[model samples]
Target: MSPAAGFARTLRAEWTKFRTVRGWVLGTVVAALLVPLLAAVSAAGSHASCDRNGVETACPEPPLGPDGHAVRDKFFFVHRTLDGDGSITVRLTSMSGIITYPPPDHDEIVPGLVPWAKAGVIVKASMEPGSSYAAVMVTGEHGVRMQHDYTGDVAGRPGGAPRWLRLTRAGETLTGYESADGRQWAEVAVVRLPDLPAEVEIGMFAASPGDLTVKQADLGGLIEQMRFTETTAVFDQVKVEGAAPGAWRHTDVSPTPGTNPGEVHHPGSAVESGGTFTVVGNGDIAPVGTDGGMAVELTLTGVLFALVVVVVVAVLFVTAEYRRGLVRVTLAASPRRGRVLAAKALVIGGVVFAAGLAASAVAMPVGKHLLRGNGNHVLPVPALTEVRVIAGVAALLAVSAVLALALGTLFRRSAAAVVTALALILLPHVLATASVLPVELSLWLLRVTPAAAFAVQQSIPEYPQVLDFYVPQGGYYPLPPWAGLGVLCCYAAFALALAVVRLKRRDA
Candidate 1:
């Protein structure tokens, strides 16, 4: 027979063998059904309603991102209007706060501010959540940082005594500086806020990121409660050199009082006490919990669980033939062992890809509908992004199926192949996302292992313009979407090559 004719015959034989197995067919159906079912269940239960002292109330309209998640932008502002380009210089004397945890009913007095707790000088275009702005601030323990919009942070001094901070604005560019004396300064960051108004609010602001406490609701849903804490910053020699208009005005933009009423306490009628002014406030200007709304974009979370079924079926597809001594028949018929293995890989990969694609296409829309039906918000993404996520998921499962089949061929045992496949493709993902390992090690695992394929389904992206948790746990990928998927494809290809070599050399 011709080489092409032999390959065609091998392909036909493998397809017939795969179809003849009822368990493998059922497993594929189960994988397709389970992903959408789990996604719906998860979405339906993840609704977050506002609660005050354990009493559910009307949730005020949450500040949501493109994907529906509660965002933090509310903070106390003590500002003076600057009519033109200029600078504000102040000495941060001290920062201290009280953090109270619930249920445990205990208070931990922090000597300094908490991480993400900020006291700084800000130049804001408006007091909107997603508006453009630049700030030079001191965080709790993370030291001095220059932050802008909401997402970007530039570190300065790591940790030390209070520092003298200055923000100079020229036209559209804003430069932040840290100084020892009021004279000598070290430039920390320079950022440009385009289309800035001729007049902007420039002043001292203090905000403490609300304490996030995770709890289980009665409905088997996850609840994230944000408890507000008061943050105080003592500023001395508060001086602004620009077109200033009169006295400073204080504005408190805290969220509706739930557990704690947010407030801003300014220097008393005594004004500057010995050239020092104090400001105290509650509420956060950082991104808050998504309140289960983020669950919609994470439709792929169910993929990990569904993939186990795929791996088992894939391994059994090859190894069952070995156990029944049917492989000898298959090899004897085709006589080209490499072609036989290739045919099996192709059949398994194609089946998984089609099943996965159908599951994801149904899951995304169904998940979104379930989330909204449960009174939860769903964040919108571009059509292209949605298409990529669905397509990527299908590709991920197909590649993983081939990998499992390759392992089965090499091992000639179903259990070993399934375990090895799981270890290579799933364990690293769990460890990385769970944050059990150090970040460096976790990142390395995703970078080098088949688990990197998970990046293909990641829909949320890191924005330097918004401040939020950017980690694997938060749905951020270590590698670019396609690049990460490419890693898994490479591994699958290598495994198949090895399997072909072993199959050719070993007796069936």
Candidate 2:
């Protein structure tokens, strides 16, 4: 055969060999079907919901302020004080909030607020002395920014002081604390108000402004039960002489990152009783809808498809020998063991490359289409950089294919080779993410692992050490995007070399 003809013959043999294997056919079918199915299921199912059970009602939009230009929306829950005793309880939009406290004189004693963005601790109050003291705690990026002794006029508060509001940027958070007398401190209120132009009011509200009869008495009695215990506090300032000052209830708030901006300012579950217009809070909270499922589903589907491809390729390569007892027959034909091995390597490598190309061509657009229509379709407009990402996926498939071939050659046992390939691909990623190992040490291992090879798809620049999150050690390897992919390609090359060497030395 001519060189081109010889390559064509090898390709033909591979196609014929794989076609006869039922497992290869089934595995490919499953891969093609499963990816789309998972994507569809994710789109249709509930990623998350604003599940406050019953402590509050959604607020409606009010008029925009003089300077406010609809930066974000806020939700609020309101309650009337039928008696001089009531407590308020509620959670953040998604563990996102900045809490401000009043001076002890306001009866906001032992003031506390829980984060509504993610799972976080309830920051209780502590204080020092000054005029109109404030304690602020923020949960997000720049965590607890101003959570110190805040002793100044309420004007010094966040939107200005003395008002002390918690603020957040994306997931970053800041906390500010203030106090007069610098001793006892009272939580004024936790603010979910975004720094953006929009305004939002969420959570429960209650009022205990003391009994109508006690309006003549001290404000302390009216401000006694100013705590959130069961439902969200809708601004209740009532008090009973004997209760624990106020109640504190805990609820899970890691889910609701915020609400759909398109759905804001609708109607009743729309307007606030506080009479303030609701606005969008944080537009930056990620994984839209606060549902962690988008990433989870995507990851699972990709991994499943990759595994199916690997298994099918391994089976195709191994079963060919089983059907013809090719080991013995080929050995007889070649007499010299090395020649038989060379033919197998040439044949299998071609098959794996072709299969990888076919699988990748099918995966990309299909996966993206399956993901469309769901709000999770973040990359609606593809960028030039996306071409690199797509190419990375294809490269990953090709490398995986070649690795599978090498594993099959190394062990000559389909199951054993698949397991080893999986370990090689998955374990290192899990370890790297854990970050338990020192960066230098872990990165060294990452340099060698097939998992790190995929790092080439990373388009973001890695921060250099000293200014970056980590410093590099001597000889420690962490490749840049292209470099990382190169490392992976090198591993695949080395494995292929080993396969060739063994094929030359071993029996069929």
Candidate 3:
């Protein structure tokens, strides 16, 4: 037979053997069903309700930016309408904040600035929250930054307060500039806002994100709390070109409605005296995920259980042959023992990939619907992001199956192979994500182990501008999606190579 035909026959034989086993087929079906089934159970267990003076109220939907993703758009804006293209220049004389419940002593309130605390000149699309905008800003400790549309951030010159920040708008394009003396200028970055209207709001703004304190929970994992904080910025030498002759409007863009603008958490205000403006705000303007709600990936919590099923099936697919002396007979028929391993790997990998893809596809939308019905805000992501996440789930399962199958072939004992496979893949993931150990150790495990492949399920990215608990338990992975998956791919390749070498040399 031709080499290609011979390989095809071997592949078909392996697949036929897999489907004929009643227990294996049942296990695959059970694995596929577990994802959405557990999602339904999870959704049913969660309940959300709000009450104002004993009156029931619906939960608030998460704020979404122009790009149709979750965002936090709360800041103090001292703005006026700019007819068309214009520029806003402001010299930030001082930027300071009050931090409540910061670390070391949770009871004491202190004066400080969070690293991301910023005040700057901005040309925004409107007073509406989540609108597209750009700004040249001075931060608390991150120096100067030019950020736009919630996600775009570019570093400028290194300076805290007393920074000269300028933002120029020309049609849909915005350019940011920083200066030491206001005479010599350096361009920070030029960004385009595709949906910017002819008229826009140009202003000075101040915002501070809450202070997050994290401690280990009594029962493993982390417990995080956001203590309310506020920032005040004083801007002198304020100049706006092409602004309409109207009183500058001040808006406290707050996430909580009916929240007292002067309250400790939402203490937002604006004052102007003799061309100097003072703005106080207690919120953030950046691309945000579902910090207050559950991530969509949470519905796929059943994947871990499904993964255990996958590991068992994959290991048994090969080890059963060895246990029954069928592997020797198969090797006798297919003298190229490497081809036998390749065929088994291909069959098992394809099965798990298909099963995982179907399960994830069903779980995602169904789980999202259930979550929303349960009064939970599921963070919105782009359609392409959803597709990538789904495909990534399948890829992760397939690669994991290949690794398990290779381990089975190497050991030729189902119990030993299954235990070793789970130790290499599942146990590390459970420990790191559950955070049974220290967070630093958890991060190290995800960075170096096969468990890193789970990063593929992360729908939202970590933003430098937003402060949050970025541990594995918080749904944030240390490595990028594709990079993390590649770690598992490497493990599978190495194990499979060893299996191929051993199979060719050993009797079985």
Candidate 4:
């Protein structure tokens, strides 16, 4: 038979084999129906809870304390040293303060700030006050602990002065470290700052209440930088001699009731040891695809599983004929070997392509509806470039199917082909990312890798260093979205072409 005729017959035969099996249809249907329903339902419910009756309730306004002082501001500010360009410095003497508006809930200090106990401030001191102690006034400790003398040193000037005030958080404790030359660190004191059910002002304060002279230093004023160093220090770098008072000062500088306490330079935001949080009062961010910022990240892990299914089916398509050495007989019937491989590729590609598109179409709307009711979804974050992103996702699936077809032809054994294809699609990206490639090379590699193709689906550009143009200003990559997807497409085509070359020259 002519190569064309042989190709036509082989294609028909493979199609027949696929239809005879039911797994593909079943898996596709499951993916299409379930994804949408679950996502929409969860999203809608969240929105309803935030509403009070017919009206959406506003977040409770910040409250005040008794000392005529408005305990603390809702907003917490942390200032570190900056270089000549106004950029923040990573040197020593950096300081960070946590300002809890009203005191947070605590077990210590009665009339404390709780849901009902809403008043006073809770502080844990690292350094002993010139002459004072820290205690729970209205609120007490609720097991919110901090580490003392965490790791890195605070940056300081040449005169052995603090470069910046440093605050570090590890596990339970938050420790403050002071540095003279951004190298050697001195132990300030360590205390469990108040943070719990109720909100409160929890930060550094310098109070000096005496008759000789009155001076309440600004904790922020002394700061040069605020760096969080070691989480769990190994202490491999420590060398101790005898009593070196100049090396470090360990005084119980806890907050004591003062006659004239100094002003808290800058109280920082309350530190919650757990839970995901964005900048408070920052605009609501919705997801991609959806109008609200909730792009339902539906990772169809089933794709990997489906690759297995395809491999199994392909092997069955070819190896089923292998039984009793049927492959030899089949090859004899079609003298042209390349024709046989081409036909198989065509049949597998068509089926997977159609199935993938159908699945995507069905899954999206289903997931949309399931997610619609979840009120927790913020408004969608839309950029003019997002439309290109949508196109890229569709392109990605097409490439996946093409690659799968090549794998089926390359490894006639179903299990082997599936594993090989999965590894090809998954491992390159993993290995590439794991190693340290330079920025330009890394971006280019990501653009060409199969894994990078999938990243186009990320509505929000996730990596500022590689994938985006500007992270702080929310800028996407300099390349247009379509252009980026094109880079991915080039990769897919290259792999497919290479597979075609191998099939033409190699024996089946």
lDDT (Cα, tens digit) per residue for candidate 1, span 1-508: 8888888888998888888889999999999888899888888787756666678864555464323334566666778877778999999888877666666674443444556678878888765554567899887777888987655678887763377999989999999998767788889999987767878888888887656666655654334555556678888888899947687778765444333443322211113467676777666655443332463457656788879999999999999989999888888888878888889989999999999999999999998887776666665555788899999999999999999999999999999999999999999999988756666787899899999998887765665423344567667778999999999999999999999999988898
Worst 10 residues of 3 by lDDT: 257-266
- Candidate 4 matches the true fold with a TM-score of 0.42
Q: Candidate 4, which segments miss by more than 4 Å at Cα? A: 1-7, 22-292, 296-326, 378-395, 427-445, 460-508
- lDDT string for model 2 (261-281, tens) is 222322112133343312112
Q: Candidate 2 local accuracy as lDDT?
A: 0.38
Q: Each model's TM-score, in the order given?
A: 0.77, 0.45, 0.96, 0.42
Regions of candidate 3 where Cα sits further than 4 Å from its true position: 102-107, 258-266
The Cα error of candidate 4 at residue 457, in Å, is 2.0
Better of 2 and 3 by lDDT: 3
Candidates sorted by lDDT, best first: 3, 1, 2, 4
Residue 15: error of model 1 in Å?
5.9
Task: Output the better candidate (1/2) by lDDT.
Answer: 1
Indicate the residue-level lDDT of 179 in model 4: 50
lDDT of 4 by residue, 267-367 (tens): 11222223211111100001111221444334233343444444455445554554445656666766666566556656755665555555445444455
TM-score: which candidate is best? 3
Candidate 1 versus the native: TM-score? Answer: 0.77
Best model number under lDDT: 3
